[model samples]
Target: MITENTIAAISTPLGRGGIAVIRVSGKDAIAIAERVFRSSHGGEVRKFPSHTVHHGLVVAPNSQEPLDEVMLTVFRAPNSYTGEDVVEISCHGGVFVSQKVLEAVLEAGARLADPGEFTKRAFLNGKIDLVQAEAVADLIQASTERSHQEAFQQLRGGLSDQINAVRNSLVDMLALMELELDFSQEDVEFLDRQEIEERLRRSIEELDKLIASYQRGRFLREGAKITIVGRPNVGKSSLLNALLGMERAIVDETPGTTRDAIETQLDIKGVLFRVIDTAGLRQAKNRIEKKGIAITEFHIEDADVVLFLLDASEGVTRADEKIWQQVERLSQKRREMFPAKIIIVGNKIDLGNQLTKGSFDPEMGKWPLVLVSAKTLTGIPQLNETIFKAVFDERWERGDAVITNVRHLQALQKARQHLGFALETLKQGLSTEFAVVDIKGALEQLGAIVGQTTPEEVLDRIFEQFCIGK
Candidate 1:
């Protein structure tokens, strides 16, 4: 709930740093900060103009005992972060000292803020819409340059403007239909059925484009998962180290050296992929090796892409064929839910030049193949390019606003469904009232995306994902 009480919290990350900040906001933010602060310039904080910073000492409210030397910045109401009076105290960056400063502010008069309360206030106060509010969280969690660009674009109203425009067009159409119904006794039509159907078709097409971008957006927002699987001693661990350019995995010439999955992140052209190196997939010789293979299968089931590694010098062994068969069965099981893309990787090509074209041709079906030597770093660049192309399609080259949030995607899906039903109704030459019902349903879903008609519990769930003090 949006409260009238002044709020105080430690806004900076809790760690040893050069500086840390405690933020206070509400109507009495200035007066509450003034109670414990004494300016080095010999003036009251309440009298200072907005956007001014002052050197000060944080003192006890009762005894005025100095606690720490600090800098206090003030922002007046209607322009502050929460659209209320805000005061931020920059104190010495010790965990204990920052705590004492915040304790003094709360002792004077301020409630401890809930997680995301500041940003929630901004949304309720109309400083920004819900889409922009979610973008604030995404901006903080962005892992790659591409993800950062998409989040910042949404925060700047690139996505919000389009959503609002769509909503307004539907609202205008709804008003015309309702107005025509009100004057129906005179037997007049305000809008043609053909025109409404055409408008709806355009809106549905727009939503389809937005929905199609989720694959790329999902990769940018949540990094892609690429799991590497192969038989024992097939250079899985070596490939992991080569791709990350570090000794992330333990590599040994002996088989079964790795007994679990080793996961690391790789950034390829601004796209992040979580690369996992798994234990050898074969008939386990021991209980421990069997458990390791089980974990490998679990990751393969959930992976967006699987790199099935094989020893190129050996040229398609029986064990490699067995693992491929298992992967095919798993693909059939998960075809409807996150079907993993399997790429056949032939490793140790530096031993010979036989695999110049990445082909076991008829030996391995129609799967994409790449040849590399993880020991010598041969063909690593081509392997990276292959992984990128295997997941991202041509839809990623467009410049439209992407749908990154799951909430936004769900809303878009529902709105598109309603619009679809309405369009079908209009094409069937039904009454405007029947199509109007679905159009209003579509409008409500679109409103929820921008927080116009969102419920209280939904707002709570959204803001709960943020850290306290925002």
Candidate 2:
């Protein structure tokens, strides 16, 4: 494994917790650790076997004063997270004490680690792929059970296995294509054109599914956007508060109470949804309200799911009809995918005036209408289920790998495009060398997802987004 200068950073969050872990990794991790740590066992840090733990006290350099009691763990090279010698000091979690401990370690010949340096080193040293490295961040930031599960699975090589399977197929095909190129001068056909065409077609289909899976995958990664929109005093804000179980949006009887979009998070069935409560969709009476309407239109155009709130106490009125027209017109650019599905909501069902499929024009009637009373939260459980069913259908079967990263999705699309070109070359009876070029392009694109061919700048951008010492 590759080794570099010793780098140390607090692996745990800096605060007044029960304890914190300081990570040291590189060629001299154990040696630097020994300088600042005096083990109770009274042996050199390097002498301890790999994966061994010991009690120690951090000693200040120059003054030789004890800093704090800690438990030091040693990991020898070729077996550590970075595939290099590593040392971990579990110290008391205090703002001042952790700082002092880190300072002592830095003074003991260890350099301060940059953001994500530890995880970056793991990727650079071949301990993990780029997808797994990104998964580390996702796992750390996961807010719901579904997000956590996806990230954990990705880290455990679920996505990597899928990527490698597709990549191997391309590799096998490319080898044969190159072999065919070699036999071109001999007037011998080493590869069958029909077989190559069939294989390319299958590979393209596999890529298409992964690309399509990005819709739900993105929702799992970054919560879904659910915009509640309707005419004045249709209980949009109340619905938002009801769903979030908190008064996140101000509820007022007066119209245009919310002049701007108020966004809050709601977790339904382990999937996150960003519920946005916007100004009632109506003719603006002021400049601020006009801007709010524009903002509402924007949200409607891009929302994953829209809650078209209609007052169930009263049937659809002219104002509701006008707002529905604007919403339909603005949603032209919305994604035609599972996450883009909408559910029409009729609030104030406690008034015993819930609407049905016969309540609106035929076009509006095509959408599912759910009745609820935001004031009493009646039918909220049904509303949650309706919202969830709108995006995630039975298609979300287990073991079907879905890519959550946009970068991975783009890479797959570009790889699929190259493969498309390869199939075209074969179908057109083009030269073997042309197909070889296309296949190579596809290989590089696929390799970039797993970091085999990723550029340095792209790596920098990705790792810089990670937390320091992870």
Candidates in order, TM-scores: namely: 0.94, 0.97
**Candidate 2 has which clashing residue pairs, if any?**
none
- Please identify model 1 stretches exceeding 4 Å from their true place: 335-338, 353-365
| Per-model lDDT | 0.87, 0.88
Per-residue lDDT of 412-447 in model 2, one digit per residue for the tens? 989999999989988888876888888889889989
**Total clashing residue pairs per candidate?**
0, 0
